[model samples]
Structures are given as structure tokens and as C-alpha cells.
Target: MKRLLAMGCGLLVLGWANGMAAAPSPDTASVDKAIVHLAPTKGNKVQGTVRFETVKGGVKVTADLTGLTPGKHGFHVHEKGDCSAPDGSSAGGHFNPTGQAHGGPDATARHEGDLGNLVADASGAAHYERVDQQLTLQGPNSILGRSVVVHAKADDFKTQPSGASGDRVALGKIEPEK
Candidate 1:
């Protein structure tokens, strides 16, 4: 009888743990489809896609950008997730959660929206993957309604923290595909 009781307790605990692992947290959601594409600019044309999923603490943003000039360009999630306007002007400033000054994505005290730079190869393509726990896709400060921007130059990673990435070349809105 004692042995059976112990076995049952162990099984119950194991089952509970498994159930928790299989369940999705209320704050998390899967980004079924995030379509990022290139918009025609007066000079260059850049395009890409960012796929993400809500993890326990934050989100994982995976991206693939191509057709940019060969160099390091600033990449960021802007304040307004709108890419409707030409030249991708619809997307506003960087995502600034802490109300900090505009800076680099990896800066210690920069804007919450700054995401640093993307390095393109000689072939003019940039590929990257990153995880962010500070952004929400549906809540008050969700990144879902934001846009991603690719700059014309490398983000210096210093100097106001925005890396001085030049003109916004490529722009895309973070939206679920219909």
C-alpha cells in the first residue's frame, strides 16, 4: 500500500509538469505570419521578413533582409508600425519604451526601440535572429502595430545610440498575413 501511494504521487506530479509545459501562457502568442517586403525607393530597394513567437518572457524575432547596400545598416522596430506611406515614412520613430533618448539597439540607456545594425554581405543581404522580452505583440506596448526600418549606413553603436544609420531604405509593417 505504501509503495502504491508513492507511485501515484509521483505520477501526479509528472503529469502536472507535463501539462504546464504543453500549455501556452496567456501573455504569449504565435506570430503566424509577419510579412516584411521591400518598398521602392528613389535610390535602392530593400526587402525582408521577420518571423516571431511569444515566449514565456518575451519574443523571438527572426529576419532575412536582402537588396541593401553592402555594409552595416541600422535595424529597428519603430514607434509606429505603419509602412503605408511611400519611402516607408509611415513608420514613426524607434520604439521607445523607457522614454529614453534615441540610441543604439544594444545601448544600456538608449531608446527602447533602438535595435542596432544589420551587416550586409558583399551580396547585399543581411540575415539575423534575435529575442526580445520587452516588446508585447498585443498589449499596451505591443510591437505588432509597429514597423521595422533598415538604414542606409552602419549603426555606429554610439553617438546617441541610434548608430547614425542614414536614410531609411527598407521598411515593413509587423502585421499578421491575411
Candidate 2:
């Protein structure tokens, strides 16, 4: 059985050397989807799920959240995956791999994790959707394992490092979809 397995492996490598298309390596294989389940931090009751799906030229981000104020709130992918802190400070700063000034998602230059805002309706529910070209599901720059944070206030979009968003009311880690 061992010899047969060796021969099969050898044959597969030989076929690839002969110009047969090889299967994509796991490291480079495309990830079709990712997800995050947000839980309220501290005393907040906000909870929701955010889905990321690959689309042409970018990833489509969709989020549905409840238990929020009836207005815009700051939202972003934070640097650290840890959400242990009661105030959500364990997640650290924004996921600014490219080292950019804080800006709206549509800005010419912004943090890779800067996802702008999520507006809650009068009923304390918010639904958001957008195509983010800067986000990646694979590669070193991928947002996987990082954390998403929902702040208590709107992102002013002109702050220095992080928008003047208030407390982190909710947090979740980005993970590959099952």
C-alpha cells in the first residue's frame, strides 16, 4: 500500500511537469465566504452577523444588527482578534495594514479595515451592504482572525488615527465561513 501511494504521488507530479494543470494549492485557493457574529460588549445588547462574499473586483459586505441607537454608528474591522475587554478595547486599533489616515470607505485612501458606518433605524435595527475593494479573504492582508467593532457614535471620517467614534458597543472576530 505504501508503494502504491508513492507511485500515485509520483504520477501526479509527473503529470504536472508535463504541463497538465495542477490543482490550486491550499494556500492560494480562493475563499468564497467569511463571516462574523457580533456580540454586545459590556452592558450593550447589540448583536448581529456580518457576511463577506467574493464578488467581481471586491468582496461584498452585508451586515444585519439590532439593539442600537436610531442613528449612525461607527463600524470597522479592528487590528486584534481579541475582544476580551469589557469595553472592546482588547481589539486594539483599526486594521490599518497600509498605514493610512482615517477616512470613509469611499475615500481615495483609507485603512483596509475602515468600513465606514452602520445606520440603525428607529426600531434599533440596522442593515448595511457594500462592496469593499480593499478587503481580502485570502493572502497575508486578509482580514480573517481580526475583529469587527461597532462603536457608540458615528465615524466623523476625518479623525487622526481612529475616527472619534465612542465606545465599542459590540465586537466579533472574522472567521472563514463553514
Candidate 3:
């Protein structure tokens, strides 16, 4: 009976440990889709990794960009997550969370898809970290089904919200990992 009791206690501890590790973080959830890949654009020079994290608040994007012009550049979550096309035209317009027109990410009245500029270093590298309270990784308005884009120009932050990045230099799609 003593040995049996010990074994049962060990099993319970093991189960509890497993449950803790498998449990999602308080402000985060199991990210259904996360794909970080590379692509070339016709305009700006960009190369880096993009990660999509599903948090309790919403979906988060962490971008590490290099080979840029060392300054402010347009960064936005596009409507489509398809970067299959060479020119990256496959990625649709900016993400519109409120179903509004395309605007800056910080714009008071703009699309939920708009995200502000990404600042690069003298070496032309930029690191972006953003958590969207309105986007998701699995819902209809989910950014997981969208694309992350880097532009060659800086978003004035006032001009219609989307700093009018001349063209798409780099692109990546957000998809769930297996």
C-alpha cells in the first residue's frame, strides 16, 4: 500500500507539471499560424524575419529587417497573406480592422490594418515589435491571413495615414505552424 500511494502521488505531480507547461501564457495564446520567411521587392531593399504571435490581447508582429536605407520606412499589415507573387502584388491592401479606409496605424480614424513606420539603423536594419488589440490569428479580421510589408519610403504619419511607401520592397505571409 505504501508503494502504491507513492506511485499515485508521483503521477499526480507529473500531470500537474505537464499541464503547467502546456498551458498558454496569461497574456498570450497558442499561436495557430506563424511563418517567418523572406522575399524581394521591386523598390526598397529588405531582408529579415517576421513572426506572428497570438497573445491574449490579440496578434503580435515582431519584424527584424535589414538591408534597408537606415531611416523611417512604412510598415503595415496588408489584407492578404499571400506573397507567392514575385512583385508581392498578391498581398492585398492594408488591414482594416474597423472597416475604415487605409490610414496610419496610430491614426485615430483609420483601418485596423495600418501600422506606423519602422525605424532602421545606420546599417539599414530595423526591428519592429507590435501588438494589435484588434487583430487575431484565426478570425475573419485575423492578421494571420494577411501580409507584413516593408516600404522604401517613410510614412509621413499624416498623409492619409499610409505614409505612401513607394513600393513593396519585402514581403512575408503570416501562417500557422504545424
Highest-lDDT candidate: 2
Best candidate per TM-score, number?
2
What does candidate 3's lDDT look like per residue over 3-80, in tens digits?
999999999999988655432232224555476675777655678987876776766778888888878988877767
State each model's CA lDDT, in order. 0.69, 0.88, 0.72
RMSD of 1: 12.3
TM-score of each: 0.72, 0.83, 0.72
Q: For candidate 2, write residues 1-178 as lDDT tens digits.
A: 9999999999999976743222112342467788999999989999999999889989999999999999999999988888899999999899987788999999979998899999999999999999999988777577777889999999999987888989999999988888
* Weakest lDDT window of 10 consecutive positions for candidate 1: 19-28
| lDDT-best of 2 and 3 | 2
Cα deviation in Å at residue 14, candidate 3?
Answer: 51
Stretches > 4 Å off in candidate 2: 1-28
Candidate 1 lDDT over 1-178, as tens digits, reads 9999999999999998865543323332554345455464457778777665666756667778888888888888877766777666778777776687766544567765677678889998888777665555654455665678888988776766466777888887666645
